[model samples]
Target: MSVDMYLGPSKTQGSTTTTVCDNYGNGLNSLQDAVGNFTADQVLRSLAYDSAKGYFKEAYVPLIQGAILVVEATAKAVAKLPSDYVSEVDSCDLKSSELEREIQRYETQIQGMQNQINQVKQLLPVSSERAQHLREANGLISDYTSAKAKLEKQLQKLLAFHAFSTMIFTEVTSLKSAVNQGLAQVSGGKGFNANKGTFSNANLNDRSWMDTIGKKWQDREKERLKDQMPNMDGLEYKQIDFNGGKVWCWVKKGRTTADPEDIEKSFLFNDWVARMLEKYGPDYFKTDREKGVTDLLVEQNLRLFEEVRTGIDSKTGKKLTPAERLARGASLVNSLAALGVGAKQITNVGKGKAGQTPKKPPIVGSGRKVPAIGKPKKTISAPGKKIQSVKGKPSKVKAPVKGTGKIYNANGNPDLRALRRPQFDEVLKNGFPDGTKLNQHAYNSLFKSGRKDIMIDDIIDALNSKPISAKPGSVEYINPKTNTSVFVNPTTKEIVGIWPASFKK
Candidate 1:
């Protein structure tokens, strides 16, 4: 018999459910396929929409802004003799802020020019002399837009350099102090030890793993996998302090192949440290010099710092002159350009000649259509208590047309019958737009996997099967022949997850 283990109360903690599927892997595959189909453009638009709604500012900006101030203060306390450092950083910061105001003014002007062009096109004749008016208007907006873009590039450089200089000053002084104090020794406990490990040069170049780990540990939403999978006996839940934050973790019990100690160390070394560096640019810890520095988005440009500070290429052992390192480091704009959300390109300051122009990574998806995407509505339920649907205007769901063989209702909701594969894929890729919530575990398993082949359609298809009586506040939909099952949280009408029906059998 195949037994699947799920870790739950995921909603209150990580907001993610952990599922270990032991037998059939089809459920996961379907989700991977769906995620793979999302274009880079779609991802960018979704991010922009969320930002416009103040979601990112509310959730992230304060912690990061505060951290950066703290980091700079500590560096100043520990280091002495560089009279120019503080003055240079302050100059860059002031210039960047001014450039931002200039860019915003240009954006407003361009938008107004565009509106005028639209009006001219709509109300004017196509005569050559009149067309010149349109041309002048278009040309004006074009020139200003290009100018704004250049200012943006300049601003990015200032920020990147500011961050880079701070990192070097902080680390060099901290390392020296720790060595003198004999506090650079390796250690780990329930929390992380940041001073004792060596970071990969590769990590400095490609920190996408940082994003993966961030989603796994930080961006999770409330979800419980155990509600969907009952009578599972192979998993245990425990609490561990992850960098002073008490969070829940799941472990497979009696597993000889995987050591929990090794797993914890991996999290500390890779995930925890990555978060620290990305947030603070330097190590984040309380020191006699100052409280820990909290900042944001430094890991994005650490490649140049890593190479210059070490003075040799970790990969090829190529030595760079002090002048060469300074030149490359000074091209801060190239490094910072890759800092865009869902950036398609990266600035590679690798083995190339010092003065060689690095290729710029452009933000992808300009003028592409962004599909409407939103979060699923949430529902809450206490453990052991019956789950109930949210009280709202009842869903206006209707049945499919008789003998039409259609799987969707006229109102754009999924019906009880299985939808066509393409329709199913579209619905799942865009999220459960009919207000059905998807928990973090299910979302991450499908989209967060580096590569997979599952579609949301498969789970929705399984949901079309005959309903099974479940424990209070939950329902199970199963298709026996396909061995596909879906767990639904009745209280919120959320789809808890899709699991293999064979396990229940």
Candidate 2:
């Protein structure tokens, strides 16, 4: 409505009793131009509130903040910064009231200083007008000094701001370069040149022996071995820490021999063991000893299983006919032997593996009365208090008296039937592998020699004293400690002599 709308009379110039309504409305556009406006920079500079100095003395703060925002926007185009702190920085502002308050504070300081100077001047005698002018001049100089100090403070702030911006630019530039270089290194067809590893590189995820040492080192080791062993064109070397020492493993690439046939055989190095070396590569077994032992057991069993399946004697190099092969594939061999066909009886039908002697199955027993397998175990009484103790030593067990430990039943008769091969049972009783002796068997027998420890008369007396009824075939005592097998005939009461265990059964 116009100015006439609210105070305009409903009737033209009509005189009426007092009827009043307040009209205080101002048009919406009346103050549009009068509204205050502020720029981003001015608002930033109005932060200080000095009683006398009023407002930001320098404009560098707003400039510094503006530069920071520009750099941040630039950085966002390249990569993520540590943090985008610019938005928080932009939120800070200065207004007139704060600046006015700061000016008032400084003004109060000036007033206080002036009063002090006036009190000193009053304490002195009265002076001429010219002298008074000189005193007033001193006051002006003091004011100028304070103002100069304040101006220098503002300049110092500008310098600090410049330094801050410089630092930010430097940091952002470094970040961008690092990110770009990293991306180009892997994605630019040049894969990272990280070490496959050294033994001491601790960053490895899998801490197995292989991973501890880098892949490059292993490959170099392989090449080195190949160069050293001309015969093993594909020689490989693996390292293992065993028995608190480092052991280097050597293996052939294929089933070929590295040395001439006439050379002394190194049983520890061979193709059969190489498979184990490969499986445990980089990933180490507990120690060198474990590796060697496991390799021995594996190769021995592998050969045994292979021979049984194919009916080919690995040692003799002889092949079996269809009938003999069928006999093995069938359970006929075990059944026949179970019925007392001699297990040691060489069945020519199964003659196999050429270029070697035809070997028989392990002689489980050597008597008509002995069954195929599984002989009873024996136990002996501990040394009793009745036996006098040896001087200077605790009561101890002497070597076993032969025939003393025979197992007996409630009937009081010793177990004299179903005999086991004593010599082998002693050496490999824990597990008598099916066919061949282990490679370590020779190593085991290195300390023992063959000889008759007990003569026939002594053996006979020893057995008769115990009242152990003898079996018809040879009676043997296998001593794993001595690594020897002593043989005798319990029924015949004769000594057959002692033999050292061999690598091959």
Candidate 3:
């Protein structure tokens, strides 16, 4: 049996009911099929696999080599230098010197280009040849500017890496000494404890002990080289600092990829990646946030992340202003009491477990009792009815409808016509016909809304719930059970359109 998942009214505030994912596991798999087409997911998959292999080889490999060189130098200094001068040979200090020299070189080149442009501009006649020279000089200047910008960014990362490496200088020196000793033993020299292990003078070149020592060294290197590698996390919503702004990203939760395919496989299982990409940019999937694409997307779009995390005022069903969020407890209580309920907790009720299937949140209109956690139960007790309690006592009576979204006629009674639609009834009883087709309009709506992950079967399942008529020969079937809706042609039995709870504005 599929695990039952409940969703609140965050996505469908005006709807009569909340959502429930009855087939949680299967429905999530279908959503995965939907997210495969997202550009952000595609970008992450590429970076963590073969497609970005060439880029890593050309760009990251050199950074790794440079960092290793600095590491080796620091280790040598720590081992051989006197305590007083050891600080002078620090890796970060050495990198800063190199970065200064590189910056000076770029500045000199840019100055020369500017001189040529100035000479061209000062010419008495503006000839076509002179204009061409001016254009070339300007182009050269632009290239230098871009190259210098990239170099500074890369060097900054290297500096941070070198600084971090200094914390482990003692360990690196010890490992290096061990490696040197192992080499000496392999060459029949007096090094390592030959008498303590199986490596006697006769079996000098035996590599069994060396292999074990090498494995330990390799593990340390992996930890040291994390900055230069593409490390992907599992499926989860993790808040990370990206491009000077905080954003919630799926690709960077607190974990590491076990295999190359693990990164891509993780992407196949969630919509947070799609939401982040749609909110920020394609760089949302970049493994190295420190060395990622430098842009204003994150800074510009962080409000959405904040809203998703903690913004909605539960009592009013409106976004809480910054001032309102930070108000003194008394003022906050008073304001909320003025709006409606004073005791309601104003927190994100829909933040589910890590990598859990995220259903559309309920748009909680005023006066509805917000659940203390997650969402209300999958079933809504019929209005005005009392069920026998688990203890076998009659439950308290429920009040009649207020201004909530439950379907009601003009005279304020439950609309039975909406409660019973024959087309939906037949589909729930016998399933859809073989020739039933999803039309172009529905596909367009889903694609534009980042909900192309909603499958046709999901729509059919949603039809099992109550429906309200929209027009002649058409009915709006909403199923909170499946978190999907279908506008159906009762006579033709074709799916005219769909509205999925996954849709985000």
Pick the lDDT winner.
Answer: 3
- Per TM-score, the best of the predicted structures is 3
Cα lDDT tens digits for candidate 2, 239-267: 22222322222334443323332111222
Off by over 4 Å in 1: 1-94, 175-505
lDDT computed for candidate 2: 0.29
Model 3 segments more than 4 A misplaced: 1-105, 118-132, 164-441, 444-467, 477-495, 498-505
Candidate 2 segments exceeding 4 Å error:
1-183, 186-262, 265-483, 486-505
- For candidate 3, write residues 304-341 as lDDT tens digits: 33443354554467975432332212222221222222
Q: What ordering of candidates by TM-score runs from best to worst?
A: 3, 1, 2
Evaluate model 2: give its TM-score: 0.16
What is the per-residue lDDT of model 1 for residues 315-356, given as tens digits with 9 covering 90 to 100?
Answer: 578995433333233222212221221111221111110111
Q: Of 1 and 3, which scores higher on lDDT?
A: 3
Candidate 3 local lDDT, residue 493: 68
Select the stronger candidate by TM-score from 1 and 2.
Answer: 1
